[model samples]
Structure formats: C-alpha cells, structure tokens
Target: MTQKLAGRTAVVVGGGQTPGATVGNGRAAALTYAREGADVLVVDRDLDSAEETAELIRKEGGTSLAHRADITVEADCESIAGAALDTYGRIDILHNNVGIVPAGRTEDLAAETWRRGFEINLTGMWLTCKAVLPHMRHRGSGTIVNISSMAGLLAGGETIAYNTSKAAVHSLTRSLAIEYAPHGVRVNCIAPGMMDTPMGVDANARAGGVSRDDVAAQRAAMVPMRRQGSGWDVARAALFLASDESAFITGVVLAVDGGFSLRAGIQ
Candidate 1:
C-alpha cells in the first residue's frame, strides 16, 4: 500500500512535550507523519525540545527539522510559515497541538491566567492560521488540523479557562473551514478525552498530590474504553485529517475521546 502522505510536507506546531513517561500529541503526530512518508517541520517554543523531536525523527531515517517559535507571537507565527516554505518549498499539512490545562474556577480565576489561556489556546491558533492561509490560498489547496479537548464540549469542569478557550477552538475550526472552503483549504479539529499524555498524567499527578499510576487509573476508570488514550491515538486521528484520505471532510470536530464525552450529564 502507498503511504497516505507520500511526498507531502507537514508542519507540526507545539511538537515538544513535557518530561514524562509517555509521548506527547505533537511529537507523536510529527513522527506518525514522517513514518507515512512526509517530510516534517517540528516546531515548538522550546528550541531544545523541538530539536529532540527532530533528532528522534532523523534517527528513524525520516526527514525532519526543528524550529523555535512562540505561538503567541504574530511574527513568530509568520516565521513558521516562512520557514516551512523555505525548507520544503510548499506547505501541505499544518497540525496544531498546543494547549494548556490551567485549573481554576470562573469565580477565582486570575485575569492574567484567563487571558494567557485564551492567548495560547485560541489566539495562537488563529495567528498560525492567519500566517499560513495566504500561502494555502495562493496554492488553492491545504489541510489544517487543530487540537481541542473534550473539556471544551462537556460541562461541569472547574477549569474555566481551559474549557472556554478550547471550546473557542471548535468555533475557530468551523469558521475557518467555511471561509476557506472556496479557496480549497480544509480546517478540522480533534477533541481528545481522558488522554494519558505527560500533560494529562504528570501534571495532574503533581497538581493533585497523587501518584501518577493512581491518577492514570482514576482517569482510565472514567473512560468507557477502560483505558486512557495515548499520544499515538491522537496522532492517528490527526494523520487521517491531514491526509488526502479525508479529502472530502472538513469543518469537523473529530473526538479522540473514549466515550467519556458520550456520558456527559449522566449520574
């Protein structure tokens, strides 16, 4: 069988991961794209971490490069597009997997914290899209995959900042999809639920003052699949959205969750 993304070039933003036992969504997506025969640009605010991902891909005999850019910065986002075009001469796929889970209730949340969350989770995505859209429109075809969370859809989360911003991502995806459909650009989103990523496990463990295994088990039990999802699970979903296999699909919010979202509002 032919590789789904053969001869394509993919730009995977937020490609670095937190230190933990599991892979991150961005790194996994970048690797998955490479494995399927796409040259990759692994971008992250953390230059060292980005290089680590790039090095891993190189070790696997895949073509990849590391780039540093803070998504919150407009110029940096523009540079991301520029770098990709300079390196590969064209941009085929753009996968956004950057997010932060800031815990706080609406009543107690700090103004700065809420602003920061929106800046990173929402505005950053818009900026990246803004930077890349011109190039894509010029070419008349491209694919963009934005990462969201089930928290965005489900109610009752105390993390107001995370939930609201991610929810906005859903809106952003659909809005871009319709606006750019005529230009032949497809925009889609993935909402991951109960993932066992470093951000999900390690961060939660530290914040909750519990063992990582305990945290993992607790989250897994809530999932209908009886297990928390890994980065690879989300990566596979991103792969489908970024490839021509889903050429006819767009403006979709594909949930990578394991039925957790399905149980929303139940006792």
Candidate 2:
C-alpha cells in the first residue's frame, strides 16, 4: 500500500519521550508519521529524548531530524520552524503535541502554578503557530494538529488549569482553521481520553499517592470500554487529521477518548 504522507514534511513539537513504561502521544505521532513516509522533525525541550525519537525513525529507514525546542519561548519556537525548514525545505504538517497536566483545585491553586500551565499548554502553542504561519502561508498549504485532552470536554474536575488550557486550545483550533482555510491550511485539535500513557499513569499516581498499576486499574474502570486507550490510538487520530484523508475536514476537535466524554456527569 502507498503511504498516505509520502513526500510530506512534518514537525511534531514535544515529539520526544522514552515512554516511561508507556509511549507518549507526541512520540507516537512522530513514529506514526515517519512510518507513513513523512520526513519528521522531532522537537522537544530535551535534546536527548528528541534524538532518541529521531534515531528510531532513522533505524526504520525513515527520514527524521531532532532539535531541542523550548516552545514556551518565542525565539525557540522560531528556531523550531527554522530547523524543520532547513532540514526538509518545506512544511506540510505541524503537530503541536505538547501539553501539561497541572493537578490542583481552582480554589486553592497557586497563582504561579496556573500561569505556568497556561504558558506551556496554551501560550506555547500560539507561539508555535505564529512562527510557522509564514512558512505555511508561503506554501499555501498546511495541516496543524493540536493535542488537547478529554478533560477539556468532560470536565474532569479539580484540574482547573489543565482543563481550561485545553479548552482554550479547542477554540484556538477553530478560529485558526477558519482564518487559514482560504490559504489551504487546516487547523484541528485532538482530545485524548483516559490512556495508559506515562503521564496518564503518573497523574493518577500523583493524585492518589498510589502505584502506577493501581492507577491504571482505576483508569480502566472509568472507561466504558473497560480499557485504557493508548498513545497509538491518539496517534492514528492525528494521522488522519494530518493527511489528505481529512482534506475536507478542518476546525474539528476529534476526541480519541473511549466514550468518556459521551457518558454524562463528571468522570
């Protein structure tokens, strides 16, 4: 079968992770795109982690480049875009897979904590879009996939900052999609549901001071499917959005959650 993304160049911000026992969405997306024949640029604040992802792609006989990028900084965002262009000469997809889960109640949340969440979860995404828009505009075509969370839609209480930040991403995706549609650029968002990813397990452990296995069990129970999703589930959703398969689709918030949002009430 022919690869859906052959000849395309993709930049996945935050596409660096060793899984910590489970693969992260960013890393999964990078690998998926690479397997589908896109030259991928893996960007993350951790040079080592980013290189690890890049190396995996190369080992699979796929094209990839890795760069350390602190997305919270405007200059770093600029450099990420520059690095991708320098390495691949063109940009067909921009996957903003970076996010932070700041666990805290709104009533008692620290002001600094909320601000930090916004910086990495929201502002960083905006800066990246800004940095890459000119290039996409020049090419007159692009696809941007922002990774949000099911918490944004289902209101998984207590994590006020994270929920709000991801909710804002959904709005950003819609507004940008409309603005860029005429330019042939599609902007979309993905909301991943309860998954067995490292951060997912870690978040549960942090909240209850329990072991990852215990948290994983709890997460599985909460899902109607009676199973936790995986980074690969989210990756495939992203793949569809970033490829020509969704050519007519834009400004969509595709939820990769396992019916978590569909079940009414708090999760």
Candidate 3:
C-alpha cells in the first residue's frame, strides 16, 4: 500500500450498509481508508452492522472500531466525535456517507417525510461537521468528504426530497469550505451517479416491485458508461479528496458518474 493516509484517523459515518451482492459506499470507503493506513472509526445506527465492518477491518490487519449513533440527534453526533477522539486521539478525516431516498413527487411527498429526509441527508451531516469542526480547527488542519448524488444536480427523478436535500449538501459543502479555508480545513462533496450497491439496486427493486436484476439492468442502461459504478469507484474518489493529493482542492462537487452527468447535463 502507498499508505496515503498513514498515521491519520478517519471517522466514516454510515459505515455499515444494507445487505446486498455488492459492497456499499460507506463500507468501501472504510476499507479503503484502512488499506491506506488510516485507523478508522466506523459509525452507524445499527450496532451489529457497524461491528461487522469493524471486524472486516480487523481481519485485514487494519485498525477500526464500531460505534452506534443516530446522527440526526445532536447529542449522538457529539458522541461520534467523542468516540473517535477516545479511540484515535485526533480526527484527520470526516467522511459523511449517510443518505436516504424517500421516493415521492413534490405534490405527493409528505411534509413529515420531506423533513425527515433533510434531517438525515443534510442536517445530520452538518451536525457531524459541527461535532468535529472545533477539533479540526484547533489543530488547523482536517478534511471532510460528503457523499451527495447526481440527482442533486440534474432533473428527472421523482425522489423530490432526496434531490433537494442533496442539492443543499452541495451548497453546504461550498459554504463550509470557504468559511474554514483560512483555518486550513477542506470540505468537498461527491455527486455519484447510479451506483450498483445493494442500497441503490435493492431500494429500486422494492420500490418498483421488480427483481433486483431488472432494476440493476435498467439503471446500468441509463448511465452513459453502459454500466453502473461501484462502491470502490466512489471510495477511490473519497480517498483522493481525503488524502493530501487533494490538498489544494476544496468546495468542489466532483461527479463520479461515468459521464452520466454529461449526458444528463446540468439542471
């Protein structure tokens, strides 16, 4: 390993993932960070699922620990930072990987559901940053990678709540980046296209009442690359944004969509 993150500590929120044939983005980023020599703290709402990810890292001779936290709760977000500090001493990277898709059109979407989606997809992210920003700012250095979606940039999806919340994430990333730049902190967002993770495929399948295979095929067909990207693709991108390689970059929303964004154009 090149050890891009050697001696660094990373907090990967939503490190646990939905069960599926393929890995999810959070799990992939955790493993990738570990592979690059970063001790990781895996946070998830599900203790068992989080432990599963921690165990995988341990099996690979990488250091990791699991913690459970409902990020929507401000106190729980504080606990995340506390756990990372207690385990790793200092946080060098904060990877926000939690997002939810509640499929609904604007007119049909429930007010409560819309609010809940924002709480998870956007507000929770801000809280986590709030939890860790002091430490990063005090040290005068840190990196944050937020996982957004192409839906935030383009139109055509019925997932009104998801699209709007993710769009807010883009704005949030830029806002934080500029605010913290003088303090030596960097904030960036990744807008992934159709990914072939269990969450992506399984959720669509259930929503469409179709087989997973059918859902996967249709999503792949939509992408310009003729295939859906994987968790590893996003992981590598996160790795770059988290590592020193992207030291000069911040507040940028990178599209890891295999040209899908180009085909769709901007909204």
Q: Per-residue alpha-carbon lDDT of model 3 for 174-209, expressed as tens digits?
A: 999999999999999999999999899987788779
Give one clash count per candidate, in the order shown. Answer: 0, 0, 0
| Better candidate number, 1 or 3, judged by TM-score | 3
- lDDT, residue 204, model 3: 70
Once model 3 is optimally superposed onto the true structure by TM-score, how far is the C-alpha of residue 168 displaced, in angstroms? 0.2
Off by over 4 Å in 2: 206-208, 265-267
Write model 2 residue lDDT over 1-267, tens digit each, in one string.
259999999999999864468898899999999999999999999989999999999999999999998999999999988998888999999999888888788788999999999999999999999999889988899999999987777565578889899999999999999999999999999998898887789756876788888989988898888899999999999999999999999999997878877774533
Query: Per-residue alpha-carbon lDDT of model 1 for 1-267, expressed as tens digits?
Result: 257988889999999999989999999999999999999999999999999999998999999999999999999999999999999998999999888877788888889999999999999999999999999999999999999998889664588889889999999999999999999999999999999999999988998899999999999999988999999999999999998889999999998888887777522
Give the alpha-carbon lDDT of every model.
0.92, 0.90, 0.95
TM-score of each: 0.97, 0.96, 0.98
Ten contiguous residues minimizing lDDT sum, candidate 1: 258-267
Which residue segments of model 3 deviate by more than 4 Å? none
Pick by lDDT: which candidate is best?
A: 3
